[model samples]
Target: MFGIFIQHHVSKPNPPKKLLCNEGNLLSQIDGKGTVYTRVGGLSCNYDKGTLIISDKSNRVALNIE
Candidate 1:
């Protein structure tokens, strides 16, 4: 009854509210606060290694650069 009504009204997924750029640069919102960020170098993430590493302009592993 009610389930059938919901099924018929299903809608497409909403578009992502975040934006991303090459080399691991991204802009997103947290707690309804908006933010934007940009990086000067490359970045990488290895799920198996359980790490998300980012680099600075000199390609150094700098997690505290900000």
Candidate 2:
């Protein structure tokens, strides 16, 4: 349920449902709804006290990348 902003327009409607990361040679994933995704960019996070922090400044759930 997301979309990418490109040329000042979103690529599609109701985007995908999952995201994956292969950073630091480690596997990380975020998923929802009925689809799955893997992308190189999404969130800026940090691991603290056994928890992964995505964003602390906004209440927005989905990411819109161009």
Candidate 3:
């Protein structure tokens, strides 16, 4: 009698890349109710009511959802 054996390997998926909103290309989120937005790499923003404002030292953007 004889038998055969096989081996398999699996790899983990890469994490998502952090995004930034800039001039000529702004990142906007619609219907962002109850959603938490976080900025990676020391980026920060402010949110109030139905508006989201993300700004840096030189640029600023405001997104309002109705």
Candidate 4:
């Protein structure tokens, strides 16, 4: 099963962010629960490895924007 979370803002030109979580069975590799975590943003990235980087040095998993 694959799960993703996207953020939405009112006045922002682009979407808030893209949070992707993938979990499923492997084809023929490991016969166990597989999980992958990744973070992507619409126009800006809160994480440094993605598209954009933010100045806020916080690693909270959730965000509340209104």
Give the best candidate by TM-score. 3
- Summarize candidate 2's per-residue lDDT along 1-66 as a digit string, tens digits: 233346336434454444332342212343465454454343555444544445434532333432
Residue-level lDDT tens digits of model 4 in 1-66: 122223334333543234332232111122235643234332222433342333223543333322
What's every prediction's RMSD, in angstroms?
A: 12.7, 10.4, 11.9, 15.3
* TM-scores of the candidates in the order shown: 0.25, 0.27, 0.34, 0.15
Q: Which segments of model 2 are wrong by more than 4 Å?
A: 1-37, 56-66
| Model 2, CA-based lDDT | 0.40
Q: Candidate 3: which stretches are off by over 4 Å?
A: 1-38
lDDT by residue for model 1 (1-66), tens: 998878776654434454333445533232234564433234442222433445445564423222
Q: Which stretches of candidate 1 lie over 4 Å from their true place?
A: 1-23, 26-29, 33-48, 62-66
The candidate with the higher lDDT, 2 or 4, is: 2
Candidate 4 whole-model C-alpha lDDT, 0 to 1: 0.31
Q: Which has the better lDDT: candidate 2, or candidate 3?
A: 3
Ranking by TM-score: 3, 2, 1, 4
Q: For each candidate, what is the lDDT? A: 0.41, 0.40, 0.46, 0.31
By lDDT rank, best first, the candidates go 3, 1, 2, 4
Better of 3 and 4 by TM-score: 3
